[model samples]
Target chain A: MENVLELKNLKRHYPIYGGVFRKQVASVQALDGIDLSIRRGECLGLVGESGCGKTTTGKAIIRLDDPTSGNILFYHKEKKDGVDIATMSPRQMKKQGIRSKLQMVFQDPTTSMDPRMLVKQIIAEPLREQGGLSSRALENRVVELLELVGLTKDHPMRYPHEFSGGQRQRIAVARAIATNPEFIILDEPTSALDVSVQAQILNLLHELQQRLQLTYLFVTHHLLVVKYISHRLAVMYLGKLVEIADTDDLFNKPLHPYTHALLSGIPIPDVQHKLKRIVLSGDVPSPLNPPSGCRFHTRCPFVIDQCKSEEPVLEEVESAHKVACHRKNEVRKLVYDQFG
Target chain B: MPKLIQAEDVVTNFYTYEGVVKALNKVGLVVDHGATFGLVGESGCGKSVMVRSMMRIVQEPGQIEGGKVVLFFNGDQQQEAVDLLQQSEAYMEDLRGNHISMIFQEPNAALNPIMSIGDQISESFLFHRKKEMSKKILEDLSADDCRVFLPLKKLQQTLYTIAADNPKSFILIICSKIPILSLWQRRLKREALQRSIDIIRKLSISNPSETVHRYPHNLSGGMKQRIVIAIALACHPMLLIADEATSNLDVTIQAQILELLKDLKKTEIASILLITHDLGIVAETCDRVGVMYAGNLCEVADVEKLFQNPQHPYTKALLESVPKFSQEGRLRSIDGAVPNLVSPPSGCRFHPRCSHAMEICKQTFPEEIEIEENHMVACHLYVK
Candidate 1:
């Protein structure tokens, strides 16, 4: 499969100031060296706890937040070479048509959209931003976009507050795809919705992806939803990718300790199924002063001396399965033995 | 199982500017002793309102129009059940945080930002356990040989004895009102703070002593939730109502909190009334489940039976709507939106969206029927 987007060691840091003089005391390394590739039309799920920088990575990819270092390569079929968009200004991105090819749907649809605007205007904002569409053309486009997102014809006249959470999310989706974005960053889009409504949105997203051939960077903490929607999964801990594999492979044969813990911790809806949950002991450490060596070493049950002293880079342990752990094999064997 | 709390024909309404929104319409359910009862519903389906009405904590513009919240505090089944709704505000105030306590959805909003975590937890002890704390202070004063000038110590002991006999004593009330004389109960406050530390430690919070001094903002989300649980559990209430207590936290933190609640249920709390929208958490934690829709009780059954053989169409649809990792298919979502409660459907609120709805379902609300052992469904299909 051809790759649509590639992140090369992307880093985003925010400086923390202190003292009377307000000197730069320290920095919060929100995105500390991440590498990822989203294949064309594939839903790549990013799962992590809050403050783990998954949202930051999504923002950086879409250029909503400026990256402190590294390259974001967007491959265009028309152009022979991949374009490095990490350092591009907003004006440059708009000039190069990168803005239209990338869009984002935020987590909270209620807050993301304008309450005063009608649904049609909300969806047509992006199209209007691109310019050149007459009133008749804009109206037709808005109706088409609404229908694509499963909204009724009359919904275009209603305000966002008049719609339910799920419907508002559909409008947000319609707006995101209005510019015909090839890659969309969905940051916890379904987290704020109820289960039944969440199913509707998820199905709509899946259908839209198929119909539009859109690649997605789905960032969420929901394990079950990610397992159901994404083709591949990436687990992040304290700003770095801890593991990446096919969704089924990661769920079935989790090598990284954090990934295993996260998978086991989910509450499965079935009554007959009982998971042998490896509940992690402590909370994720502060990103400002992440633990020395491996960030997860503080809470890892299989921590060793080497894991505390030396940082482990993400290495491919199996075919297409990558993990950043010093004792991945040992942890895997123990988990297998315990489950068996 | 002996009944712990039961809400019968509970009707709650919110009188908004637009109209009267019927939040809870004749909702009824029973939570047995030592069993976790889960109330699962959508956002405005009255799950929270039902519990709030039972606790008599419904905010302004909302009224619990009619209900009998019978609480069986005596686990041995000897004492008569108390109707919480019929009680005076003073009695209800005393009953809350003493026999039945509630944990809210947002820990940040639930906790006071200005107060230290220790002071917040100690407030529960100070409010409901006043007499006990007074007695404990008296005991401490008698046990200690150190003298604060012997006569002053004697006077302090006499004051604590009065506080122990009647917490709302006239002299103590006047003293509490005054600035300088309020120090008379310092020992009692200290005792409550000490008990706060013990309860925080019981929740397995690291550095309980240190955590007590910090504000709510300083602690992590999970730690703040644990503190909220500590405040709820400080008095060791007979019933603990956790309303979406873990919904706002991350999955890992949610797991930790759920595990802690499970352990606490086994050791501390007698019965848990967990209200949430997540069926998965209900399946994992609850012994029995109640499905609520548009202010009405749709179904009630054992957790396993409800999952395996759901009776109501809405319940079945809800179960099928949740995406399963082990299953693959296009999800069958319930068509149409949740009904508006300002003027809900005449009979069954779910009839409009229900696939198996009959003519009778639109005319009158179906009476709850026992389809099997401990399984109750209130659908017109089950009526026949």
Candidate 2:
């Protein structure tokens, strides 16, 4: 598979102002430094707790929130070369047909959609804004998109509120795929729906991915759902990537202490198989003033002297498995000895 | 063990502008003593309605149409069981927080924004712990020889006696409401606040005194959740209804809250009716699980059994729907949406979505059949 999207040390920092001057007192390091790469048709699941910059990374990729620094290199297949999206201004990117190819689906379905617009209008608005679709052609395309997401063609006539939570999510998916975007940022899409409906949406997404060959950056706090949908997974802590590996490897033998703690936190839906949970005490620290060194050292059980003073760079510990921790081998050995 | 709370053929309905939404259609359930009973279902499946109806706390226009909620109360397990539906309004009001309290889903919305955490938690104590506080004060008064305020002490003693006997009486209720005459309750309020501090501290809130003084908006989601749990546990009620208590929280925070509730179950409450749509929560915390769908209890089994050998199609579908870890593939989803409760399908509410839904399933509702010991399935296939 060829690389579709590459993010090199992307950073999005919001300034925190106070007092009379309203000057830049400090900064909320929302996305301090993110470096990730995606294959043409692979699903990369970004899992993290709240305020971990998973959403910010997704938003920044599409230029929804302009990053403070770093390169967003997009590999346009037609041109046969990578174009640095960071260098191009918003206007330049819009004129180059890059905007239509990059689309996003928000977490909350109801809030993301317009209530007044019928399903057809909502789905067609993207194509309408892009121009060059006849009224009849647009109607047919809207109906086709609805069917692709497992909804009936007739559903295009009804309003969003008329649909159930699951159906509303299906509509959101329909609208996202309407523009034929190669890569879609699904930010917590199934998090709001019920398990049954979540399953439906997941299946629909999988089906759509296969049919359209769509690559996805699946962002969610749901570890289990991410493990199921993503080909590979990346774990994020306070504005930094802690671990990234094959989904099964990460779950079976997580290298990073934070990843280990996070995986164990997910409650297994079984009564007999009682796994020891590494329930981290204390809340996620303020992003405005995160921990000094490795961000997770504050909550990590395997924190050491070196972990407190110096940040550990993301290093490949094994085949394609990267971990950001000073005591990776010791942590893995400890987890294996106790849990295996 | 005796059943802690039993609802027999409970039917609750919400009369909206469109039509009468039959939220609970003859729902029957029984929670045993010292057990964590979980109710699992999707959103809009009436899991909340069933629990709310059992507690008789359904919102406006959502009426408990026809059913009896029989509550077995021994407080210390020494009295005859009483039917809660047969009790008077005042008795029910006393029983609500004293015997059975609830932890709502959204802690932010559940708690009063303006009220301090201390007052919200202490209010539970004031409603339920008046007699205990008054008796303790009386014992102290009798022990102390100093009689500086002899007349005031006598008046206070009489007032406590009256309040303890009938907390909802016009004089006591009026006084409890009117802030001016509540000077007598200052000591009781102080005791309640102290107890609230203790409970909050036990919940792992570091600065209990500081937290108690802050409003709901001042606290984080996890802290607010802890405070809500503290309020629910303030009176040590027999049954605690955690209605999706940890749903709105982050994964780590949710893990903490779930652990807290699970730990508290052993030491605090006798029975916990844990209501949530998350199967992982049910499998982890609950001993027995009840699956609801479109106002019907589809399946009831031990947590292990329900997860392993699910009988009803709906239960099977729901269990399979959860994105299993490492299966980065498509899942077999239950087709069709939950039927409109106003005009639900004639027979089983899940027939339209059930893959094994037979002709008989669409004609008449199936009786709950116990296929195995202690495991019941409400499906036509199992009816024989």
Candidate 3:
């Protein structure tokens, strides 16, 4: 299967300024090296705590913010195929139809969408920017898009504020799909919504993906939401990928201690099944100067001397199961012993 | 066991500029001594309002129209439980800091900005135990040997004359050293301030001495929350109402705060009425849970039972909608948004969005049904 989107050795760092001269004191290593690929029609869930840089990784891929360094290859089947988007000039990227090819559904639709814009204008803004749409044709397209996203045609006249959070999100989705993008980054699309409404949004996303055959890079902090929506899952900590595997495999057997602890920390809704929660001792380390060797070593329950001296590269231990840890086997044993 | 707090048919409504917002409608829940009861709901579900009603903290435009919030305080002597709500405002004022305290979600907002953290914490002791405190002050001021302290006695007489009307003012001037009353006044203020510093230390704050002097804004979010918790627990309240206490924190910090609250609950032997929108937090910390929707409790059950075999359609949908790591890629979401509480749906408030909604659900509200010994749900699907 041809990969629709691929990120290779991506890194994005924001420099921190200090002192009288405002000199560059240190850099927040937001996205330390990351390598990931999303196949056509696949949904990859990126799960992490706040400040783990999962959102930064998504922004980097969509070129919402330029990456400090790396390659972002977009496989556009229609036009010039296999374009390196990272190196493309802003004008060239627009001309290459990169923006329309990869769209983003932000975390908060209430804030993301303009409150002043009517639903029709919000959805049609992408089309207007892409050009070549007649006034009558654009209006018709907006109505169709609204209906497709489970809204009435009359909704086109309403403002974003008139809609509920879930409804506004649907309008955002409608806008994302207006350009008919091949890939969409859903950044905590349902986190702002209620559980029941969250379910509706999740179902809508799933249905939209199936109908459009679109690929997704879903970023969220909620593990359960990731589990339900993602075909494969990646666990991030301190701006680094700790584990990546088939969602079921990762949940069944988490190799990285951080991933294991994160999974165990989530309290299951079932009352009969009591979880032996692995309470990580310390807070997430600051990104400015993450721990030596492994960024997770400070809070890792199974930290050893070697873990502090050498950083572990993400390596595949089993089919579609990759982990970055000095002692993957030891971590696995500890997780199973505690959870199983 | 006596009920620590009982709210019967509580109705809180806010008269906003737009319209009358029925924040809470006939909402009722109970908290017993030494138990943690969780009120779980989505945003705008009135969980906060219900707990805020207990503290009489609901602000202007928000009126508690029809409800009796009965707080039964076990008398210090007679062992008889007294209805705190029936007491006068002055009595309630006295009881606020000492009997039933509250910890809010944002610690910075809850704490005083200008006051030193230590002074704010000690204020509780001052308000509740002023007589006992005065006795301790007198003991500290008394000289061990009257003969050697004759000059001290003369100074005490002058200080007493100055303190006859305003002790704080008299002590403040003497502590600045008029040369005569410096030592005694310094000792007095230091003793009171030391007790405040001691409470900060008891909350497990890293450095009590430094933390006591600093204002609320200087501390981290978690540390501020801890300070607020310390102040709330200072007077040993029988019931602590935590209103969205951990909602503002990050997940790891949230875990630590929840753990701290749990530890405090056990040590103080106080009941906690935890209000939150996150079901995951409720599952992690709450022993029993109540689900609210559009100003109505749809279900109430033991945390385990609520999660495993939820009888109400809303509860089942809520559990199903949560995306779990174990069930990635197979997530199912419920359709539709929450109904407006002011003018809720005629029949079942949740019927408009329910997947299993029937025709009768659109016209008639379901009565509460007891599915198990302690589990109760209000949904047409379960109603006999």
Model 3 chain A scores worst on lDDT over the 10 consecutive residues at A267-276
- Residue range A10-122, candidate 1, lDDT tens digits: 99999999999999999999999999988988999999999999999999998889999999999875676788999988898998888999999999999999899999989
Model 3 — TM-score against the truth? 0.89
Predicted candidate 2 versus true structure: per-residue lDDT over B232-330, tens digit per residue: 888889999999999988888888998898889888889999998888888999989999999999899989899999988988888777776535446
**Where does candidate 2 stray beyond 4 Å?**
A336-340, B75-79, B141-182, B326-329
> A201-286 in candidate 3: lDDT tens per residue?
88889899999999999999878777877889998998899999998888887888888777876656555556666767756878
Strongest candidate by DockQ? 1
- iRMS values for every prediction: 0.9, 1.2, 2.3
Query: In model 2, which residue pairs have backbone atoms overlapping below 3 Å?
Result: A228-B328, B74-B77
Clashes of each: 0, 2, 12
CAPRI-style class, candidate 2: medium
Off by over 4 Å in 1: A337-340, B75-79
What C-alpha lDDT values do all the predictions have?
0.92, 0.87, 0.81
Tens-digit lDDT track of model 3 for B304-369: 888878888877877876765345445566666777776778788888878888999899877778
Q: What is the lDDT of residue B297 in candidate 3?
A: 82
* Candidate 1, RMSD to the unseen true structure: 1.3
Interface RMSD for model 1 amounts to 0.9
